[model samples]
Target: MLKIVVLVSGGGTNLQAVIDGVKDGTISNTEIAGVISNNKNAYALERAKENGIPELCVSPKDYDSRELFNEKFLEAVDSFEPDLIVLAGFLVVIPAAMIEKYRNRMINIHPSLIPSFCGKGYYGLKVHEAALSRGVKVVGATVHFVDEGTDTGPIILQKAVEVEAGDTPKILQRRVMEQAEWKILPRAIDLIANGKVTVRDNRTIIAE
Candidate 1:
């Protein structure tokens, strides 16, 4: 069995996907170790409560310094000894120290195709807004290994979604979540949990 620690900040729609997958045995041989958030009021905590998973809230504002905040957050994460750390809408930027420590053991599912509507200043509805603004015919999701940079990690898996006409950011966001994000995320977790993922020279080779 694999132990997974999930981090979230907002509504936790992706977190719900993971939880449902585990409950239904779609993601077998895995147990959610815990869920942690930077915002105590995050609805994700409520989701965790419903699923009977432990929750940790370590808000960045509560700490006097960035280092202090990172140290405390890492401590909570380390306590679980998670086999995989999934960033499901966690808003905090991971420090280099934590990135190096976790390395390929951590993964994040971004809302749009990587190398496109990603990087700093691109998140939530903003990503979809950019896509619509640029008129990219297609948009999707990417699950990648977490490196120090923003969404610049080694690509693991991606699913594409067509940009429908008359699509607002909210509409596209919902579409991407349904058509891409929610699907590949848990599937990636399952592949890693089942010993089917391989990292080679900064790229992931999925075992078929």
Candidate 2:
């Protein structure tokens, strides 16, 4: 079985989706070895504990520098010896060192289609607000390999959500979260697990 490690920093709705997917055989060949978070109070940690998954909080605030924090975080995650790392809603900017070590082994789900409205300072509800403000007809989510750059990794999958005329950031976000985010994330993970997806020349290729 593929050993999986999930990282989260907020409510664990997406994390729940992954757990359910694995339980139901939608995502095969994986066992969630651990769940890590930067916030001790993050609700995702509670979910992990409830499910009997090992949980850890390696807060960046406890460290003197980003590099030090990254080292500690890497140590915590490496303890699991995970085959894959899933970022459910983790908010921190992971250092390049960890990115290099994991490379295609790490994956992240972003709120926007990416390369468009993604990077430092663009996260959570802020991404949705930016899309809505831009009057984008289509807004959606992306699951991609985690590279050194922000959301610039090879895209594994993308699902679009239509923006309604009267939609607020909250409303649009909820719609996309349910219709797009929840569905595509597990599928992306499954693809990686099953060897149906590959990153070649920084592009994701889905095999038949």
Candidate 1 residue-wise lDDT, 49-157, digit = tens = 9989999898989999999999999999999999999999988998788898998999999999898999999999899989999989999999999998899999989
Off by over 4 Å in 2: none
Q: Largest lDDT belongs to which candidate?
A: 1
Residue pairs in clash, model 1: none
- Compared with the true structure, the alpha-carbon lDDT of candidate 1 equals 0.94
- Give the whole-model CA lDDT for all candidates, comma-separated: 0.94, 0.90
**Estimated TM-score for each candidate:** 0.98, 0.97
Compared with the true structure, what per-residue lDDT tens digits does model 2 show for residues 1-208? 8888999999988999998899999988888999999998999999888889899899999999888998999999899999899999998888778788898999999998878789888898999889987888998999999988888899999999899888998998899999999999999888888889888999988985
Task: Score candidate 2 by TM-score against the native.
Answer: 0.97
Deviation from native of the Cα of residue 108 in model 2, angstroms: 0.6
Model 1: residues >4 Å from true position, as ranges?
A: none
